[model samples]
Target chain A: MPIETTDIARLAQILENSGVDTIEIEEPGLTLKLVVDTRPRIAASASPAAATAPAADHFVTAKADVAGHFRAAHPWQDKPFVAPGQRIEAGAMLGLVKIGLLYAPVVAPTAGIVDAVIAENGAMVGYGTPIVRILPHAPSNPLN
Target chain B: MIEILSVTGPASIQDLGRFDQYRFGVGTSGAMDDVALRAGNILLGNDENAAAVEIPMMPFRVRFDRNIAFALTGAAVAAEIAGRAIPPWWRSYARAGDILNIKAMSHGARSYLAVSGGIDVPMVLGSRSTQFRGEFGGLHGRPLRVGDILPCAASTAAIGELGIEPAGITLARPNAAADETIVRVIVAGEYDAFDATAQDLFWSSSWTITPQSNRYGYRLQGPAVKPKEPVEKRSHGIVPGVIQMPPNGQPIIQMRDAQTSGGYPKIATVIGADLWRVGQARLGGKLRFEQTAYSDALAAEDEMSAYLDRLRANMRLVEETRTCR
Candidate 1:
């Protein structure tokens, strides 16, 4: 399913709120990943601005912040994510990966249509590997 | 044109560095004193990443064939123009027949000298940084030597005042200590490879920079932290701040010349913004490991970039102010 792209900082904020540690995507060749809050946590405010301030959202995803090959969710599986017609919800499992010594899990960003699956499953994913495109539902504002 | 003088302690052409070349086995090699490099560039109205001379300790001398505007930053070195005293960390106007000289570093190990316009050197691959092992990039891929002349691009001489204006620069110099020692580190890699006790010793303990310290890495002398598991993984790309421990159990903080890959387990990595502190470490330097969160690292990097921008802006203001005056 297509998942809306969120900046790393925003993803960091999301992870912080959810208290999640590891994010893994395994599509065999497309095994990408990101380990959040790995280093000792420096004291910082959970400011929304800090969450959305990275230069490029694609590269700083919850997966492989460092530069490297883009990977798929599962090498032996059929596809990495839903195609243009697939549907995904917020907090849904996206994929998985086998890093140095751990199995990481990838998840969906929001409820949306799978507009596209950008990367080939099981393909090597680098930092900011884009797996699926999500058409997010517009957020409702009660205050407005 | 820049003239070649005595190749002081260690001077070479440098720029920001190379990136995204990990798969190709390329290491990121660039200016050791990043803040100084930016400051020097701003003083000369040159691009922050423009190639310049990075002097680490010792004194160097050079004769110029023409007039030029240059600035010194990072360490406090006794500099001269044609044997006449000049200020450190500030811009100086040199004449065609003048010679430039640098004395010992009063504080930090590395100092940067940026000329107006910047260094006019051919780019190697994608940078002007010198990679000694590759035997390519920056002035024939070697340290500056006697009788070597470098081409300089023309640039403005002042960017306002150093302290009064905004310049996107971050001074990463270590704090002065009565004893020459300080090692700051953040835990990373396979920390569990070592027993719990070793991990404790690694963080709580202090280490001394061994005499073997050089451009490649710092051989640390301290309590041993051996890994519990025998690591046999293939050697992969490493970075300047990576602390790789061989079976000997001693730690080696890799530097600019570190190998592209290593099989030994990594215990920690120095944060990006603080990498220069590792760069400025001299022989016998003392070090203490401090754990900083990933968020802190990101914030530090972002802040450092901002400082560099401010420093650049300040430099431009200083130059414009000078010209108007």
Candidate 2:
């Protein structure tokens, strides 16, 4: 099982004592194979409960996938397409960009409500920049 | 089954590599010499993709905690157990508590040690690879050190003796005669920024790999490559081998440690399979770039993968046939 939380210490303990030195777990067709150090002594010098903190609440700063002019909203409208706390899905269009003579829509990477907008409308975006932050809500039907 | 007695130099757990996680701001850093990594696995009757210890210039010392079979590959590193030299490539069964030692590597830059069932290390982020940038993965996200006891899982599969061919391996190094290195790039989004002379220089001149080269990126010391047009752009996703040139014109080839996205202008991309060859290049190794069509790049990648597949299949067949005899 994927460690329910990101706790490194607890995960280490479970792996050491489990006797199953290597655990091959799969979720959503993605397999995660972890080799559990059966000789727990290797990590004996390591302290448990080290990485139990939550991920920092960093702002979403979506950049352009390619160099293009940022469109804050849909082509037909003038106001911004989304405000803070607006829910969005994966592949949902966050905005548009003008590349050459073509207008391309930037899609959301994850499912979450809109969190922040770093680029203003008509601004140019480059590679390796954040375009939108989707604050994922609790799964309504996780199994789905 | 094999106990580590002593370990010097940079040794770490490595697998095929970390992948499909670059979008999460992670770099796909793994074994520097993958050919050696696979050979080590074949010698141990383990999966070719199993994790192993990647050591560079080793004086490696290990004591067998139990009776186990292990193999070493890559470089011309000499091995000795209890002061008696052991041959490379072939698997040898060591008794419990036997001391195994390795001297300096003569030719290549790295060596791999594969124990049956592979080295036991907790996985992080879907890989046994040690990605040091995030300070996570591998054995506590750091290089293995002395007194670090490694465990191996028990294997139920048949133990097959390997016939290792040490002299058959070939290692790639920098071209000594070339005065300049030209790294080819297929112009991506912003190819129009430079005037004719600048574009001419980008393809013709050789770039030196600066001493600052690391898993994150290799900064090239050569002519500056600027775009034909000037305009500020927001950050987008980035990939390995993307030659990103900032305002200074010096291009930096992003390696495994590159961020997921960036605002720099990218002129070209290195093919995926050849990225490891780039990783093997030591600091100060000269690099030459020549443009190949994207289709050609894909064909090269397909051919390489197919060759690897055949190599693995042949290794497996040889092991099975040997055990039967």
Candidate 3:
């Protein structure tokens, strides 16, 4: 039997009510994906290349040099080592990775403002896994 | 030197332990987590067996009377110096009058604070450990109290390095989400006396640590293990790691401060290497036991010694790197 339009509408309704961002269903002859439109209007206002150009130029990712579990801060510390928008000096520790019985600190390459934290705390990360994004501090151009 | 500003829970000065004193009816009183004490001392360039403060209960606050380098290890507890957070198991320098506060444990049960030259208390019976039962050793033989003044020996080693990581080591109690901690036991002393079913239950059933557990012993709650017959055993020499079964049938694993002798029948003894696991186990934690061969126990000890050796080498390398920088 062919699928009914009402069935598809009911599945979409279930996905919306469940609060999931996306859901996929596969049948013998049909595959359906329902995704909620969650992007804000401001992001849609800019052209794709123009929107990405600034990020590519200003943001630099701090990656783990060693493979291990990433920690935003020491286990005993309640606050993260660096927070988004916080100004950090060169050589400042941005995060830590615990590889066995040793902790390797991820230090900032240069003085910068933390743009975003990419790796989740306590998540296992491999070598070169981006942990944080930083925007080099330029006195003339402050992040708004 | 350091001064105890306030202590919320039981805290004591401990070294490796008082050895060769068991014959004198004295139990070896030492840091419950000896591995942590050793690690902390190593980080500070002190003797591996140097006396350090073992803070089992938390919210402990103290002030350095003079500049000193210290390391905190073992339990992952929130620690701060003058309101600045410090990493667990890392050694750092503190200025005079800097208040160091250790909050409740976030993971694990005991924490060790080792100064560069160790806590300078009069050694009693060839040891600086606290004998709580006699109340004679370690800072007047009692747990640290508010307003107590603790003397710290002048440190001779240079420890200017910062951000030293404990690196891939964790000694905290296994969290609830993880599988039950498997403690390897060497079946001994009357193990054959238990009925087959009881023996099976002893090995298979998971045990929960009761709230009554302390430095002396961990009272476990699990299926009762009954002997094949009503057997009475005479009181004999007992040491840490002996799992005894009393009338209630629940097993009680003796610990650092356990009595020198007990009348209960001993079913098994936790190997020397894994005792730290039991030491770090918190109340309400779950654990199971697996019968381990004597050869395996010895091998485990060898492995533990190797790990310690590696830690020492790594820390020395860190110190050397700092000096070069």
The best candidate by TM-score is 3
**What DockQ, on C-alphas, does every prediction get?**
0.01, 0.01, 0.18
Between prediction 2 and prediction 3, which has the larger TM-score?
3
Docking class of 1: incorrect
Q: lDDT per residue, candidate 3, A1-144, as tens digits?
A: 566897667555444433456877788988888787666679666657776786688777788775567889876567889999898877667888876566777878878889999888987766567788898977798645
Model 2 over residues A1-144: C-alpha lDDT tens digits?
Answer: 445544344444445433446656677856666676555475654755445324335334444554457777633234565677787666555776655323445667676678877666776564444667566655674422
TM-score, ranked from best to worst:
3, 1, 2
Error of 2 at B2 (Å): 5.4
Clashes of each: 80, 35, 8
State the displacement of the C-alpha of residue B84, model 1, in Å, after optimal TM-score superposition.
Answer: 3.6
The DockQ for candidate 1, computed on C-alphas, is: 0.01
| Candidate 1 regions with alpha-carbon error over 4 angstroms | A1-144, B155-184, B319-325
- C-alpha TM-score for every candidate: 0.63, 0.59, 0.76
Query: Which should have the higher lDDT, number 1 or number 3?
Result: 3
Kindly provide the TM-score obtained by chain B of candidate 3 when compared with the true chain B: 0.94
